[model samples]
Target: MNLTLASGAPRPSQTFRTVFPVLALCWLAVFFDGMDVNIYGAVMPHMLDDSGLGLTPASAGTIGSWTTFGMLIGALTAGNLTDWLGRRLMLVASVTLFSVGSAVCAVAGGVALFGFGRFVSGLGLGGLMPLCLAMVMEFAPPRRAALTTGLLMTSYHFGGMAATGLGLTLAQAAGWRWVFWAGVLPAVIAVPLLLKLLPESPGVLLARGEREKADAV
Candidate 1:
């Protein structure tokens, strides 16, 4: 039986109504960000085994730092641009940029190229979390906002686990490049829905003087 709370909200079974459509889309977007973050780690051993690439442990660490560095810059930059570009557009751009980076890594012929790809992917990965969290908080019912945020965050860990699973099962059989190629899947899966359904942040609209649009959103 459906249960009711003292505050008049339904129990867990009925909390689905508290979730907005954008929550699912943002969750998917964040999932890919996690996967892209870990894809290189998942396939690093295999990549290192190839003699032609000449990836020493020292160099690998440096390359890994590049990704992290890109993310640092991306987060700071995206944070400032949130007001100007709006959440939905920035989120789409972040996903698309990383997917393109993953594609570049998938086709790269050498260590330098792969490192560059990782850096590019990191840039997008960095910016997606704040955007996703902002959207989730904006849409969640006031009473359940905290729970919805926690749920959204779990998707990141799950995405990382999925990357590890893919590496264990398919990286060797399909090749390392295939692992990076898989990173592009999020753009294909999430971009269309986000473009069609995700709404801009009300705060952003109000800041830009679109009071009517902000109220409607």
Candidate 2:
């Protein structure tokens, strides 16, 4: 199917049709990303209360700083790496890395291990935001790019809400570990959908010298 704009150009309606699936996938992924990123914060109070974890307020602050530091490195590296690797691969890698980190957190026996897990997860979390934003912007109608970006960002808050809800309910009952387990669920749900539905950026395909694939999009 084709859609016509005011300029009388014959554009593919299906061009934007791909937008719904991709956007939904990106939204869910970002939502999970947000929940994972905030899970530590959401459960910090309980973590500190657990004497076995040996977490103090000062140590907690230090760990938070370390996670942020790791995120900075992740974002910078992923920006350059995305150019070399395709978006879909990077997205999958990011989701996988973060999910592993969440599992590590769920099973962590010491503060050191938990900190390390958060730092590792930070890398994936930091990398995902820009990539999703870029994809949404590129796929959206030119005039609606700003709106699309805004809409994409709302997923983060939704994820945060989910995290908050989980922290309130599960953290009190099953404990903080369960909250971390919840963080890992996104990887299970999102990675497969991304692999199946999210198409490679046409521009990226063209740049990689896959002209036919680019044009086929």
Candidate 3:
């Protein structure tokens, strides 16, 4: 079905063909976002047990706050950056930032370093969800926008569950650091796919007066 804007120009309603690629990629990114976010909580107990890291309950809480603070900063800035950088770059950067942050956490020798890592990851985590939601909404059928958003959010929970499962198995077997290493997987897995397959947002193209590019998208 074609939709008509207020200008009476017909806008193409994206079918599953166009929608699925964006949806799947966005979903996978969100899944990793969720996994990375929850992995901290899942492995917190083990972190506290490890004496060398010096993670006390009070410091742990403070580190968590740092993560939240970084998230606030990232969330506030990401939308503005999206206008200039576009969704694909933002997504790629966000994932890479978090993955690199996770690697930092994996190697962190002390509390300060670990907290800094969490904060860095928080920035990426905050940016990723909104970018993904916006991307998916742009491509979804108008009538199905809410449904697609709902579907995208489900990956987050699944990812959290996966984090829990990893905490249960990998943390116990290898160590908490290994769980953080696992957090790096999203960048390794999603970045290549997103760069290859995800289309640029047509709305963004149009906003930039690149109507021909927008139409191609």
- TM-score to native of every candidate shown: 0.90, 0.94, 0.94
Candidate 3 C-alpha lDDT tens digits along 132-184 = 99999988877789999999999999999999999999999999999999999
On lDDT, the leading prediction is 3
| Model 1 worst lDDT window (10 residues) | 11-20
RMSD for all candidates, in order, please: 4.3, 2.2, 2.7
Worst 10 residues of 2 by lDDT: 1-10
TM-score of 3: 0.94
Locate the minimum summed-lDDT window of 10 residues in model 3: 1-10
Clashes of 2: 0
TM-score between model 2 and native: 0.94
lDDT score, candidate 1, position 22: 71
Q: RMSD (Cα, Å) of candidate 2?
A: 2.2
Instruction: Predict model 1's lDDT versus the native.
Output: 0.85
Give one digit per residue, the lDDT tens place, for model 1 in 108-217: 88889988988999889889998899888876766778888998999899889989987887898988888888888878988888899888888788889999988667
Candidate 2 runs further than 4 Å off: 1-12
